[model samples]
Target: MKGLLVLLICMLTATSVFAGKADTVKLRQHLIAITGTSQPRNHQHTAALDEVATYIKKEFEKLQGQVQEQVYTVAGKEYRNIILSMGPADAPRLIVGAHYDVCGDQPGADDNASGVAGLLELARLLHNHRLPFRIDLVAYTLEEPPYFRTEHMGSYVHARSLKEQQAEVKGMISLEMIGNFKDEKGTQRYPLAPMKLFYGSRGNYIAVVQRFGNGSFGRSFLRNYKNNANIPVKSLRAPAFVTGVDFSDHLNYWHFGFDALMITDTSFYRNSNYHQPTDTIYTLDFRRMARVVDAVYTSILNL
Candidate 1:
């Protein structure tokens, strides 16, 4: 009986690992598709943005999700937010969002393509999972400059619409930039220098960024995410006044009184290629990126 018990434990551990592992090949394929466009996917490049939105919509549909386009116009030009709703329809929502827009003329791989790739992979992982709450995987546009922090942003439109409709949103997580990491000792930097005392100086960890009083949903997510983390996971809880805390689509959700946090690789603090043309698919680490997605998927399931 003792030997049988030990064997069962080992088998369970192996199964858990295998089940939580994100498909690295799928992650790479999604990244390549998003970054391989001939023109940059910026607001000015409406056609490219539309194409990416369509791709995201189709990918979600392939998972047999109830996908829809949240279309809105900005400066008379139309932009879209692709949404994939799953789980119980009437339950409170748990939003997982990523922007598909890039800044300037860069490929925006780490800037956001990584986040979208994670979103796509998460959709695949969540397809058949039975959960109690509704999960909305959204790919937003106009998170880039000239529209960022503006009402014209796709995230803003979605959040506002949810508010108008009085939808019950439990919390939101923005996969901002989940592909960048560095093992070098001095690769990581923080908004406040004193933070080094707690977080150290390596950019090898994924950060769960939250604001003060992020509410019960945010706290519960942090707990579950840390419990399921495979790679290094560090959380930064600060007020919005702290730089980079509210820099993603989650900020729009916050505006609508929803609890939200961002899961990121610390962006410019670690990724020097941020917003540069060099932020291409080549700069991403797909294996580590898949691990990030795995962590998120398992965490949400545990939730």
Candidate 2:
């Protein structure tokens, strides 16, 4: 029965890929809670920001991570970035981050609450695990307009500070809109027409996107991520002209010359509810989202 034993071992290995706190139900509840937070347009709400920041900080503490806040101000308004660290203090750290703010007044469930949920799930699964490098889970503020792409963005500030500290940064992984998925044909669109033929017209996969000349980082991570993932994952290396590649917090890391990639569902390319009041809990696929979180864990361990 040698063949039978081999098959059994293979099944067990696959099952272990998603073991522990990568629970889809729990992930759904977390996303729902985040989406329910207040979303105020045109103005940054310090109260809402503090509420999420506190929640993130406490969650990390429960996992025994040392939590820190990077507080700053823009135009006389205050903001904060919730930071948590695991592994050795002297090692070069790997970053896992997601922005928590919404665009204007939208519920922003898919735009980012989902990404934050993924980050939390990762923190939970990675507990007690040892790695060669440190891992930092960062919850950022103001990734959306009118602050997007500006130096005021929480990610930009964090990246700059890390550079100044001369912190050994391995790289940054930014999760953005990882909840939306589609199976029907013609559901996906691209900024460039030719991409449709190369990538396909179905919005049914998670994307690991890196800028040109950085294929080594994104491709390796994407390969490791897809190795154990049950869901579809597409990896791409393109220039900044390719829309959505630099759409999230990862762009800041790239600006600082750090190798970074975005893990996403393609955002507005697939989700019609993007940045709209209609973007809510019901529009996302929590199961697939959980799979993405698990993949991130697996990729980090493999890296």
Candidate 3:
């Protein structure tokens, strides 16, 4: 009987590890596919954006997700937002979004390929789960400048459509930049000086950035995400006036009074490669990135 109990314990442990594991190999492949296009995946490069969108659509198709294209035009040119929906169609929704467009002519590996890769991986990981509610994994385009805070932004269009349909959106989380990290002291910086005292000076943790009065959905998501996260998870709930608070696609959701937040490595705060040609795949830490995706996956399940 004791021998059988030991065997059961070993089996349980193995299952636990396997269940929690995020496939780093798959993450790397997604990143390479996203960042390796012939031209930079920027607003100016419509064909390159379409290439990335095709890749993302194929990936979602592999999981048999109900994929659709949110097509919109900007200044006579066209763009697309690739959406993959899972779970009951009528159920209230949870949104996880990332922009695929990069700034200027850079690989944008960490700038946003990291986030898009996370979105794709989450779709793969969540495909097998019997989720009780709808989850939308969106790959938005034109999130980069010239469209950043405008109605033309892909996220803005998506949020507006959800509002028009009166879709029950529980909350939204934007994966901005999740691949940058550092162990050295003073490597992290903040918009304000006092923030250093609370958040520390290490860029090794993931952050959840929300506006004040983030609503019930945002609160619950933070609690669940923190509980499930394996790496150090830090969160900041501040007014939008605070720099870096409303800098991503989540801001569009918030504009419609939806509970929203951003999960990031604090872009431009710790990552010197932000918007630079140096923002290549070589600078990313895929293992930790997988952890970020793992935590997000578990958190979504619990939510």
Candidate 4:
């Protein structure tokens, strides 16, 4: 009995260490380094974005995965979306995406760098893992203002093309913001009133939000993530007309009739530094971010 107790304690200790390693400050520093470009406008951050994409591509390639670049021009400036493929090409595809662009003023650490970091980590974790379906890890270019909700939205372009070509996209998941959390109550807010009852005021839980027609996907994802992830999760599905309902890149896929949902930290609602210059890397909780990435990877593989 003593030996068994010792083994259990050791196992718990090892798990705690692994979790701590995943949440290191280095992940946040890496995000800040990438978003800290010379110029925020005029593709000034393009090179930085490319550097991140290159790193992700190389990591996948090292695992013998396939990588593709989808280059597109926006307002006379060039931007590229990096796509990494795992598993058979002919299998049904599930896209996991996050935009790498920042607004002109801020580094966009929590606005999106958090999401990008999560996506990159997810790619690394699932690179060589055998899965039943094809998974595409996409790093999109323009998901912020001037491009958001417009025809030039990178996700809009990609989803529209798929719709036009009749591409077989089973589903898509967008990681908008996943690195900020607060354990205190009343730290979290919502666009609607009734949501306060369903979710806690603490920002520790990851959110799986979808529109009315896409609630099933949100519910399923929440169930899968909650069952597999170490952290808490909350799901919200409302009509598209609800304010702040269509807030992320997932909105584009919904426009194309594809099953899609946004896996977010409820940007602006809980993130105090949503789009400000103060939204730096120091504000995120990378440990929680890593767990979210792990849950996303598991969910996609199972899908």
Q: Which candidate number maximizes lDDT?
A: 3
What clash pairs does model 1 have? none
Error of 1 at 90 (Å): 1.2
lDDT of 1 by residue, 125-196 (tens): 888877898999999999989988999988899999989989999899999999998998999998899999
Residue-level lDDT of model 4, residues 17-60, one tens digit each, is: 44433434546655865666665521456666677667656655
lDDT of 2 by residue, 1-303 (tens): 999999999999877754653788877877767776655422367777687778878788899667899999899988989988999988999899999888887778888989998998899889778788899999999889989999999999999998998898888899999999999999999888998988999999998888887646666787798897878888878898777879999999988888899999999999999888899889988888988888888788898
Task: Give the per-residue lDDT of model 3 (tens digit) for 65-147.
Answer: 69999999888998999999999999999999999999999999998999999999888888877778898999999999988
In candidate 2, how many Å is residue 293 off?
Answer: 0.8
Report the lDDT of model 2 for residue 240. 83
- Candidate 3 structure lDDT: 0.92
Looking at candidate 2, the ten consecutive residues that score lowest on lDDT are: 35-44
Candidate numbers, best TM-score first, in rank order? 3, 1, 2, 4
Ranking by lDDT: 3, 1, 2, 4
TM-score of model 4 (CA atoms): 0.87
**How well does candidate 2 match the true structure in TM-score terms?**
0.92
- Please list the C-alpha lDDT of all candidates, in the order they appear: 0.91, 0.86, 0.92, 0.77
Model 1, CA-based lDDT: 0.91
Could you tell me which residue pairs clash in candidate 2?
none
The local lDDT score (0 to 100) that residue 236 gets in candidate 2 is 77
Candidate 4 CA-lDDT value? 0.77
- After the best TM-score superposition of candidate 4, give how far the Cα of residue 251 lies from its true spot, in angstroms: 0.7
lDDT winner between candidates 1 and 4: 1
